[model samples]
Target: MTVSVLLFIILAIGAAGYALGVRRARAAAGGDTRKLHSLTGYHGQSVLLFSAVPALVLLGLWLVLQPLYLDHRAGAMIAVADIPEGGSLDLVLADVRRVAEGLDLLVASGGMTEDDLAAMGAADSDLKARLGGVGVALAGEVGEGVFEAARDYRHATHGLSLAMAAATIAAALAGLVFALRRIGTDYRARNVSEGFVLLLFIASSLVAVLTTVGIVASLLIESIHFFRLYPARDFLFSLTWNPQFRGGSDLGIWPLLWGTLYVSFVALLFAVPVGLLSAIYLSEYASRRLRALAKPAIEVLAGIPTIVYGLFALVTVGPFLRDWFAQPLGLGSGSSSVMTAGLVMGIMLIPFVSSLSDDIINAVPQSLRDGSYGLGATQSETVRQVILPAALPGIVGAVLLAASRAIGETMIVVMGAGAAAKLDLNPFEAMTTITVKIVSQLTGDTEFASPETLVAFALGMALFVFTLGLNIVALYVVRKYREQYE
Candidate 1:
């Protein structure tokens, strides 16, 4: 049976068990609620939890591990000679899975039978054409070993699926029987049910921690693979960024790193003062009506998609800057330049800084402003001295958060700044960032084992580390200054 059908059956059984447990508890208590250790509802909940939770856990484990076991067995069946040149075992395994699925579809459609599939030979039959008729396309002709492996894979999968369903249902029934027998007047059903709930809450909290660990682990492993193929010093300190798929390549990171920091610095240089001043005006000086109208208007910039921002950078901002500033100053001739991307990215970052700063400024205690006013300080003086210092930590955090956002931006950099990686001092010269290079390196037909493809992971790891450093600095600044204010 299918997993969904089995889940439905298990839930139905749990429902029946709940009703039976409640009835049994009332009978044991002589239909007197005062005699029971816990409420009748707790007894029912206990029965439901026992009947469903174990079975669901088992089903989840089976679903996760079954495919891994099947894949290993199928991979073992394919000989090394069967894997084509310029291909790995993973590619062959993909073909085996596709062919196996196609065979199942053919059998279901009455185009083939189990006996026919068993008797089929790759030497005599056009396997690709037969599978294609059933809507499964292969990259190349299937070998005899792959065909046999696929057949065995399908059979093993079918057998395991049946076994999983039976075992899950049996577990549900066992739990139901055990809980029903334990449903007495003296049973501590409430404690047991609440324990399960506590465990569930703990598991939910660990999910975020586990997810972060998984991301770091994956990036670290792939980066290690990349570093083994290429020198770490060259990847880190070399002055150029170029990748050759054939043999020799110059995969330096400095040009990309310089472009990323230069763009982000330009963006922050524009965004911080404007956004912070806007926040100050809205929070401390503007009337309530103006605050309501202006805050949402500013925040609307954040809602527009990044791709839309990229297009705006491409069509409007890039050309306007080229014609008005870059050409007039003779800094550069190109429409796509670092200044173009930085200005457009600064526009995009305005909402992030303004909204966050406004909220943080407003969060400051009113008493500080009142005291400053009582000391005969003007509103502007009070803001500059007392309010600004108090909100400095949060403002720093907001700026760094915006910086992280700017560093990770790809579409704007690609559209506004051209994808030329170089270490130049001119903001008007087109350059690329680490994110752009990561995408370029991974695009098109490339081998995962090659340095070009693997470098994407290394770049990603570097970005992650840089962003993590920003967050750590933000945290330290907040913690160190926040105590004095509090």
Candidate 2:
């Protein structure tokens, strides 16, 4: 029984249990719903929750742990001599998994039978040819040790899967029986159902919190390893950003940080004014029909992928700026420049700002505007004094969100802004960001043990810290403004 099949069986059992619970509860109450301690739906939901949750939890744990157990068992069979020169345990284990999967596919697809697989050995059978018949390609010929390990892996996997299916089904059935037995006229099904719902909400929140903790812990560990190999002072303070995989590299944060801030500043400068003005007009002056039609059309820009914007910057905006503005103004004439990426990124962020700001502006009470007008104030004066101040906190939040979006963008910087990391005041000069450098450092054939590869995690940690500070500042500004209004 596969995981999917097992899940389906559990679901079918849960559904049947729900129906039975509802019917049994009504029967116990002599078909009088009001005589029951809880609603029919609550009884049904309680049974469903009891039947599904424990079984699903068991299934999830088994699936997660089964792979680790199998890998450990298989890895034990491979001696140091089994690994080829210039190869590590990870590489051998990868091949072991691949071969194991291929053999499973071969057996399932009827390309090989039980008797044939049992009799098969590296000396007796063409393992690669058999796998290929089932569309599983190996990089090289299967060695004797790897072939034996894969067979063990397949056997362990099959046994564990069968055991998992049986255990999960039994758990679900047991839960179903227990819940049905408790479905009496006096049972507190409503309270039980609400408790289950509360547990679900708590589980969802824990998943998000745990995910953040995992990211921070991973980054911190890898960054510590990175700092051990490379001096933290050079990485943090040095002005240069040269990462040589061959050693003696100056892996500094300044150039990348400078470029990130400069590009984001330019983008915010372009987006905030235009987006806020557009929001003001839409909220304060536009007709309902026009606002409805125009808002979605403007928000359509948000749906246009960042990659598409990158291409737009690369082909159209980059050249246009270089030919007209940069060259004519005696600035740098590179087609790929910070200005190219910044302008395209600003266009991409317009919808985020406009939509959020428009909603915030509209949320300002109509009574405030009316009072401002009654005080002999002009429409513009009313907007400036009453509506703008009221919407200031939300507007700040929107701008900060857009700024975060700009700072984290990679594709536009890659395509429009060139990959040269430098600190320059000239917008026409090509530069790169931390995200782009993070990507560059991690890619290619760079060894993970090297400081060059580890620097990616350090860069990531810095980016995380910067974004956290930015959010803190945004919250402070918003709170200050909100207090004044209150």
- TM-score of each candidate structure, all chains considered together: 0.96, 0.93
- lDDT per residue for candidate 1 within 271-314, as digits (tens), equals 99989999999999999999999999999999999899899989
Q: TM-score winner among the candidates?
A: 1
Candidate 1: C-alpha lDDT: 0.92
Alpha-carbon lDDT of model 2:
0.91
Model 1 earns a TM-score of 0.96
Alpha-carbon RMSD of each model:
1.6, 2.2
Per-residue lDDT of model 2, residues 1-486, tens digit only: 767788899999999989988998999899899999999989998899889999999999998999899889988999887788867777788888888898888888888888988889866566777777777666556788888998999999889989999999999999999999999889999999999889889999899899999999999999999999999999999999988888789999999999999999989999999899999999999999999999999999999988999999999999999999999999987899999999999999999899999999988888888889999999899889889999999999999999999999999999999899988999999999999999988899867789999999999999999999999999999889893432
- Candidate 2 colliding pairs: none
lDDT to native, each model: 0.92, 0.91
